[model samples]
Target chain A: MFEHLSIQLIMGQLLIGLINGSFYAMLSLGLAIIFGLMNVVNFAHGAQYMLGAFAAWFLLTTFGVSYWGALVIAPIMVAIFGLIMERLILRPIQHLDHLYSLLATYAAVLIIEGLMRQQFGSSGMPYAPPLRGGVNLGFMFLPWYRLWVVLFSLLVCIGTWMLIERTKLGAYLRAATEKPDIVEAFGINVPRMISLTYAFGVGLAGLSGVLAAPIYQVSPSMGSNLMIVIFAVVVIGGMGSIVGAVLTGYLIGVVEGLTKVFYPEAANLVIFVIMIIVLVLRPNGLTSGRGTST
Target chain B: MNSDANAAPLLQVKDLRAWYNESQALHGMNFDVRPGELVTLIGRNGAGKSTTLRSIMGIVRKRTGSICYEDEELIGKRTFQIARKGIAYCPEERAIFSLLNVGENLTLPPVLRQGGVPDSELLKQFPNLRERRKSRGTLLSGGEQQMLAIARILRTGSQFLLLDEPSEGLAPVVVKEIGQLILRLKAQGYTILLVEQNLQFARLVADRHIVIEHGAVVDTLSAEELVSDMGRVKNYLGV
Candidate 1:
């Protein structure tokens, strides 16, 4: 491996891998949380991410909002949208089979994607990076914005993990996920907790979108394009395992990045191949059955 | 025993009918638990004894008819609301969260009122749980899980308790311990409606027993009457 590749090339690919991993960690974490508590696959998650990016773009163009402002506001707007969707559409069909929610959220995806395409067209829109400098790390040049994204995403991911694993509210969530009716009998408002959980999960997707806007082209199809890979990430991580989702996300991202460096043709197909391997060897996922702990 | 015959009933269920989808689990359940009384609902398997407790907690959503707690209607109210009005439930399966530790399970239910037993007292009452405080619910034995199910609700300060099969599948010694615990709870003036298949255990701890068959109350017997008519009670239980 060292014979063909320079240190700079390896470092550069690794940095790119980490950046992609950050998005994967955030998006898959959202998916895992929603699926764990709500039992909904949330097929509309990709659309929600698109909506988050668009919300940021719209805020910047229409109201002269800064990148900082969009960061704070866009996720909140997406969360509100998630809250409404969960209450009006998902809540009614909650008693139905998992396929029902999958289809319903898929329908939402089509509707949202159609509207965004009509409004913004299929072309990718450019969002200016907030930070404009790069540092020479001796091995490779690193962008300050990329470093910020990776660090910030790590913070958010760790914060969320701690919130779910350590806090009192998290205890309620974990307990309710196991037995909602029993938790309700304990005087906890479980239905409300469920709705809020869905909202928070989408809010995470929205945050990921804002982070990705400056790196990737913000477009109506950006989220859907990335969604296939995200589903693969979730499967490899396990369906409802929170820690599995987060860890598998970053791992797959790095693996894909390394593949691009070593075997460029297999970069796109590597994660799916790993998914098949994981499915064959460990059907429940790598970190499942630990009982919600990482 | 604080059994005042003229005192208003704390909980009154009149003609309560519940369904699980298309199948009816409870045809019509009628019972009353007076304040400070330890009542038991005794019946054979599939006799809707568990369903009756579920109906009271509003866990069975398709229930019709009235469940009045402290003279307030509870049929249309949500489970949490019913709980907020000072009622707690311990399910048959001891549905403890396997993800949570014993301590977390113990304190999971919020304190609904000020009179709830503290964590220290609950640990003292079930000393086995004290040793397993850091262990997850999955790590607990059958008796420990049952103790956790009953112990968790004590912190809620709910005067009314709906316990389903607290002694189910436990050792005889553990069952006796549970019976003693129930007697202690009764002495503390907590109004409990227990669903038990073990008539001997029910007779030991309960002040009154309501015999259920096919979702309807067949007989109501005081502790004295239960002993006097043991043959009739055995017939109702099909033992």
Candidate 2:
């Protein structure tokens, strides 16, 4: 296997792996955050990501907003959308079983995807790459936009980690995750915190979509296509562990990429296989204690 | 203390009724706590002593009737709104955040008023907590968790405190320490409503004891009266 593979091929696949890993990390991180605090599976996350791409495209074409502007505006728009969804739909059903939220969000996925398909059609739309140039690093050519995605996502991940793990507000969030009523009794306005948290998580999904628009096609099915893989990533990482979600996402992406190079047939199957193995071996997940204990 | 006796009640509960879903927990409960007073709600397990505190804090949402704090009705207010009006609750379970370290748990509650006990003073008071500041909530012993629960609320600057079962599962020495801490808080003029199954512990720190049986106050006894009627009090506790 090694003898037939050139250094250039391996490097190219590695870069692709890193880019995919960045997406996995961002999507799974959002999922973990939402699940951790709100106890909602957020099935519509992929739709929100699609919405981000469409939002960016809409901004660019309809209003002449540059990619730079859309990059910031799109996620905010998705967050506002998420805020409304949480307040109107999720909040009322919050006290019900976990299944209710799952169904509700799944309904949202159908509705959002249906609306997008009706408007944009099933075909992929091309979004021009913000940075067209590539850099040669001796082994392979690296697209500037792809490099930007990896670095920018990594920065966002680090910043989120710091915010959740290091700050006083984060302490409130962690406490609320465990006991929202007690947190409320302490005058922290836990309901408002919960609403904002869900919005923030979906905002990450939107940001991921914007980053992916230049790389992958912006289509109605784009988010749903990635949703299953992202779910597999969340399961492999553990349901609510922030660190587990992020690290496992990147790890799975790279593993899948490597499989594509060595054995293309197993590329798609690798993540599910890993998920089964992880579930059997470490049922509580790799980073259990760092997340909500309940 | 005599002057505080004449001061208007800091909290007044009148015909307060609460339910856990379909089952009622508090039945026409009534009590009052004066400024600078340390009161204890003494009852058996499942006697709704804790629920009374929770009802006052608005944790039990199915509650009705009146919970007046500083003469303002609290029955309709949300928990956070009630909390904002200078009342703090330390739940029976301690409810510490396992993900947060000792230091974070110590300062988790927000200060609702101007006179919150400073973090420096609280750390000094609970020196053990200071030493294990970086350790997670699960790392603490039962007594330390209880201490952390009580200490955290002190920083809220809420003159009124509701503590549930602080000495429930602790060793004799730790229970004495908690009693001393309660006395210290009382000395500093912080009004507290404590729930205790330990009749002995109640006698140690409380100025008055409100006996709850079947979710209603059956008797009110001062410290001097409680000491004289030890046999009846122990009988009520079934200990």
Candidate 3:
């Protein structure tokens, strides 16, 4: 299966896989968190991601904020916006069916895309790389920024794990996910937790956008397109555990990468194909988690 | 109503009505829970017992009445916000996060003990939780899960807990354990609102029973008064 592929071709596919893996991991992590804890699948997650990238572009091009500044500000601003959406919009519809929630977020995606189109022309905006050079890894040359994204994403995923699994607040977040009513009965501010969970999920999507801006064009259509692939990732990973999302993202990224080395034609189709197989074999996902499962 | 009782009622519901879209579920339900009072809402299915709990916690849709906790208006608050206002709700489903282990389930909510409830104290109070600390919530026996559910709320330090059907699916021995736990919470100065179908259990544990049928309060009576009128329980609950 691997005979005809050159070592260079193999490395090329693997590196791209890693880069794609970073986004899939981050985006799916956010989706899983929001869905698991707050019981909202956050269809607008990708749009939020695009919004982050565009915010960075707008900040740098129009406001003169540095790429570094936008990296922090864009995610924060979008996160605050998520908080507002939760308070002003999502909270009211919480009692409706899960389908209503899914529709509500889909509407949010449309609203965000419309606003972005009005502000930035329909044409995609280019993002210049913040840090300039690539490091030669004996097998292939790796861009400094691409490597930063992987490492930073790993740190973020781990940090989030620690916060939820080890910290006191994480405990609360998990508790809220399990039984918000029960947790609230304890006199704790569970609504605040819901708002923050949404913010954190949206913020992760924003962070992924900042990382992708230089690599991909900042466009209104970015999130919707990537969302489909990420949803596939969520399905295969089961959207239950944070680790499952991140790990399966990278694993599938590599699987797709390996396929490209041997047969480039199959690379794009592999994720969806795998998603179908997984759904058939284990519809509940790789993790046996219950509650708001994607 | 006594001296040194200046603090507001722990929970107060006035003409609180709730609906699921167009259908009304709770009709002008009026009730109050004094500090340290163990309150139970007892009624047959479709009697607005669960709806009253959901409406008070802001988990139900289309609520149109007053829900005040410590004199603060709770009508507009979200379920989580109402929870933040010092309330915890355990649904009738026992919706414990199934995948999370017993310890994880207990630890998930913010267990801040900043002049609030503490987890260690709860573990101390419910030794069953500590004993089965490593078990998954779903894997635990029904009684154990119920105990863990109660323990989870206690861990958060919320003195007021809205527990729905803690005894509904448990074994007889487990039901007895639940009754004991309710008394334990009452003894510890915690106020509880329970929706119980186990009349025997309710009679053993409840401080007061507020009976409802078709969304309106039909009766309020003491535990001793209830045993004497098993006829009423048979009429209202058909048990």
Candidate 4:
């Protein structure tokens, strides 16, 4: 059974895993940041991501905007929506228990997805790849757009990690996450920082959506399926660790892909299974005490 | 309200009332601090010494009454806005960011005004912090953490410092070091509002001592008066 597996088959599954890992990294990173700072489990993250893909589609269909232009405009549009959501919805109930915030975001998910479904039906819509064609390697063929997604998302994750870890703004963010009142006492406007942080987190999710638009179908439920997987990734990595989220995302993605090759039935269950195991062993996740989350 | 040309109070609190949800912490609290004056708030554990400072800084949200600093009312202002008005607070608990190193913690607070103390002078002032600049905030000893907590705010360029129990949970020698640091800051023309349970430490540095009992100021004594009347101080503090 082991000898029958060809090089092409192995390489293909690995590439698929890498593609899934890119999305996982991007989505989980956003979730980690939002959760770390605001202590709000942003269940609307998936909906916001779907909106990103839809925004790209709408821009292309209505305004004749290219994919490149959508890449720039879509995330900004979604981020503005995120700001509005924070101000109108999240801020009002921020003082309540953590459970309320989770519920509110979950409601937001329903509303956003429902609205999108009403506008565009449940059927999937196609998006043309920004970079067409594939490269023929010795073992397997690789699509340029898939490669772009992997590389671009990798750069994004690294860049975001650097911004949060090495910069002055990052220092304020980290401190604010730990103690918002103390941060405010230091002459910094902490409430405004919370709003901006929520926006930035959602903006990253929107960016991931735009990147996924060309590969996956542009549909209302696009993010819902992936959201659970990303959440599992976040838990396995650690609740709020940036490096853990990034690394665990790719690692799990490859593992899931490997499961598909070895045991097709376990591919979908692998992430959750890993999540449960991590919870039992290390309740704070793999990279504990690295971020604001307990 | 005195209208003397040179004796205007930098901080003035009148009839301040604060509550932690339903439990009242402060009731009709009143006090005043003039520029360059180190006013010590001395009281027993439940007498609202910390609450008075917190209300002044807008940390206690359910607070009412006037907290005028430099003639500007700080009653309705947010914590950061009050901070921007040249007032810095160091809480009794010494809330240092555990994840941040000493160097990072030192630079955390944004300098409000133009002429705040620079990093070099701050590090020079707290030599212990300079030695442990690269160490995590929680890794420091109790004395070093206290020093870092106080030193971090010096760079904010704030005119008034609200220090709450800086001498708490420190050894005698470390307490003396902190007292010396306070005197040095005063000599450099920094106005301080100190909250201390240690009456001896209060007597050493304060120009005036405000005695609080059951959330209200019962007496205001000069440093000379505090020295003259140890019995009254002991009665109010219950030490």
Candidate 5:
């Protein structure tokens, strides 16, 4: 069984793992922030990711925009969509229990995915790689786009972590999560803060979708497929901990890749297995960072 | 300017009713606090002392009636909007962000008034907080957390402060220190509406006492009235 496992194969798979982990971290970070701030699970996050891909594709095909242009425009469009959703849909149900918001987002996912399918059809479409070349490492070949995804994603994850944990704006977001009323009583508009927070989280999801379009086919179901894995990452990382989500995302993605090398059969099931173990052992998640306040 | 006793009250609440979902908390509550006056709302656990403060701050959603601060009605306003109109609230739970450091928590509230107390001045007033500026809020003792909560609003330039049970669950010595802090705030000319179960602490600083019972104003007394009518305080508060 170990005979065919060469260094090149392992390194290649590790690269793939890193790319997947980058996406997991990005998506889960957004989820964690939204959950931390508003206590909403944001089930429509995947749909928003899909919308980002579609927006990029539309910019390229319809407006003759380049990958770079989509990179800038797509996330903003999706974020605006998220802002509308939050203000119109999520805000109304905000006073309800967390479960209702979760269900509402789940409903939003269905509506968004359905609309996309009707417009673009169910077939996957190819998105040309922006860099159009590969870099040959000592042991294996690395695609420029994949490397871009990894580096850019690392930058985003770190930047987002700093923004939330180390800045004055972040202080307001965290404080609002614990006690919105008190934060409001401090003369900070908490409802507006909450809306902007939701927009930011959804914007992150949109960015990930733009990054993912080149690697995976642009399709209606692409985000939904990846969403389950990202959810597993969020749970293992902990529901609302930013650092936990990022670290666990990369760790689990690599674990899944290694499993593919050692035992190909367990690759898909590996993340869920880890999630189950974490849930049983630490029900609050690996890092319980500042659980949401009612 | 601070000696405006003959002018309209700095803060006034009239027939303010509020509720949590369906259960009512403030039932036609009415009270007033003059500029530079330290007023305490004193009653037993369920007498709605806290509710009265929350209602005035617009923290409770189902509030009705009038809360006039500087003559602006606050009945339909959001808590943040009411806060911007020169009021701050320090709740009984302290409401400190467990994830934030002491200094961050101290300076968290955005300054609304031009002459809001600066962080340096607040740190001078709270020397312990200055020492523990980098410490996480959760690591602080109950006394320290209470200090952070109250001190947090000072820098926002809020002319009015609503403090709920600042001395609750603290050691007697800590309570004494808090009592002194209240006197210091009073001397600096900040109007205050304090909610407390501790009659002794109220007596130490408040110029007037408003007794609340079942979500309404049952009586009002000056420090002199309170001293003479200890039996009334004891009866209503059951302390």
Candidate 6:
């Protein structure tokens, strides 16, 4: 007798996996960009993501902001915070050893988290989904918000890729990764690019947070634990490569989902397990990766 | 003064002052890279040859000078903006994006020049790249990577190309290959500013040669004068 796990159950897991993958892809891609070219492990990424969720929650609660408004305003606001961090903090540490950047970001994460805790307290608060109700798939019930998360996140990811890979600004960004001085010589201001790149990258994480608010409990330390999994995803994807981040994010999420079906215990550890396999097989990743570090 | 049909210099540098941090490199230096001319900034190591090129490119952050590229003031402009106005730099480090393949390295920024040259032109010039088309830049041999770097800029077709010691650490045969490449670029009307210690390569490609000792232009001479005058050569380049 077959253990008849229905198509509905399978589809549900698939949807969950894809949604989780969307956030993973966004988070890890940003991590890859920052780590690859700048060579900084941005420990603040999770905190930044949490800040984004808080932005959405704050806008909604205090200003009666619509989901649409929070979607745009939250990311821009978080990006401004990111811009300040890059200009005031990250820029000064550009030339220091790798450890300095790590320490700097770690300090930033702790401080941001602490400040958020002070203001918001320790409890998690629920936010209503912007896109309400479930879409009826023949096999399963798919939530409209979850579907939006996958679709919108992919759109943003593609948009980012187009910006970085297809445009003149992207050329300079990729070029900056190769020869900053040569790019500088070409009369492209490298510092401004660095700042913009930081802001754009952090902005991606913020957008993910806004998207995540309805799904996740909004709290100060929401970003804290999620970062560990994303780091593993980044490593598995290869550091600093955008495509790799996206791919690994989805693949690992699916694998984790499948693992939950087969063996529940392994589900939580699946990403780290994949990281081990990748380290042994290809230190890089499935793709060659753009100019960002691998 | 800008390049003119009647009487202007192609590029004019007046009191070009530059520094790294507080340590000044170019001290009131003056020079010109005439239209369609190949000029050499010849000097010993730390003689500011490279600094001169960087300063002209507007890459030097702490720089004060009148660098006229055609009619635009290059002093205050940003680096890529300067490049958009028709100037490119090939650093001494041979700063190729090792992660990219040979083909990508060639075509990332299309030639700014209006010659309508395709990447095929680059392949024709350096057949080696075609041979290593799929190879990662890091996988290339020293000579191959150098050729790729130079070929990359040529594809861009920028009016002015600044090449910093393309022959540094290259074999004699590779140096000859580079000399031929530069000559080919010059023939196509690419204005080149070459910084070099390879006297032989400089002699082959340069129409006018100038020496920098301690960041100031100690002497400037035509190629003919350089061939004949031994005093400046012996004093500055020690050759």
Q: What are the per-model DockQ values?
A: 0.81, 0.71, 0.36, 0.64, 0.66, 0.38
Tens-place lDDT digits, model 1, residues A1-294: 447788888789899999999999899999999998888998999999988898898899899898899999999999999999999899999999999999999999999999999988999999999999989999999999999999999999999999999999989988887889989999999999999999999999999999988998899999999899988999899987889988988999899999888988899999999999999998888877675434
DockQ of 5: 0.66
Q: Per-residue alpha-carbon lDDT of model 5 for A1-94, expressed as tens digits?
A: 6898999989988888999999999999999999988999989999999888888888999998989999889999999999999999999989
List per-prediction Cα lDDT, in the order shown: 0.91, 0.91, 0.82, 0.90, 0.88, 0.81
Clashing pairs in 2: none
What lDDT, from 0 to 1, does candidate 1 have? 0.91
lDDT of 2 by residue, A107-225 (tens): 99999999999988999999999999989999899999999999999999889988888888888888888899999988999889999999999999999999999999999999999
Report the error of model 1 at residue B66, Å: 0.8
- Candidate 3's error at B173, in angstroms? 3.2
CAPRI-style docking class of model 4 based on DockQ = medium
For residues B131-185, what per-residue lDDT tens digits would candidate 6 score against the true structure?
9887777788888888887777765557788899999998999889889988888
Q: TM-scores for chain A, candidates in order?
A: 0.98, 0.98, 0.95, 0.98, 0.97, 0.95
State the fnat of model 6: 0.52
> Can you tell me which runs of candidate 5 are displaced by over 4 Å?
A289-294, B1-4
Model 5, C-alpha of B172: deviation from truth (Å): 1.9
Clashing pairs in 5: none
Per-candidate iRMS values, in order, are 1.5, 2.2, 4.3, 2.1, 3.0, 3.3
Scored by TM against the true chain B, the candidates give 0.97, 0.97, 0.90, 0.96, 0.96, 0.93
TM-score preference between candidates 1 and 3, better one: 1
True interface contacts reproduced, per candidate: 0.95, 0.88, 0.45, 0.68, 0.82, 0.52
What total of clashing residue pairs does each candidate reach? 0, 0, 20, 0, 0, 15
Q: Answer with 2 or 5, whichever has the higher DockQ.
A: 2
Runs in model 3 deviating more than 4 A are A1-4, A38-43, A62-64, A84-126, A188-191, A218-225, A288-294, B1-16, B28-40, B64-91, B107-117, B155-163, B191-194, B206-208, B232-236
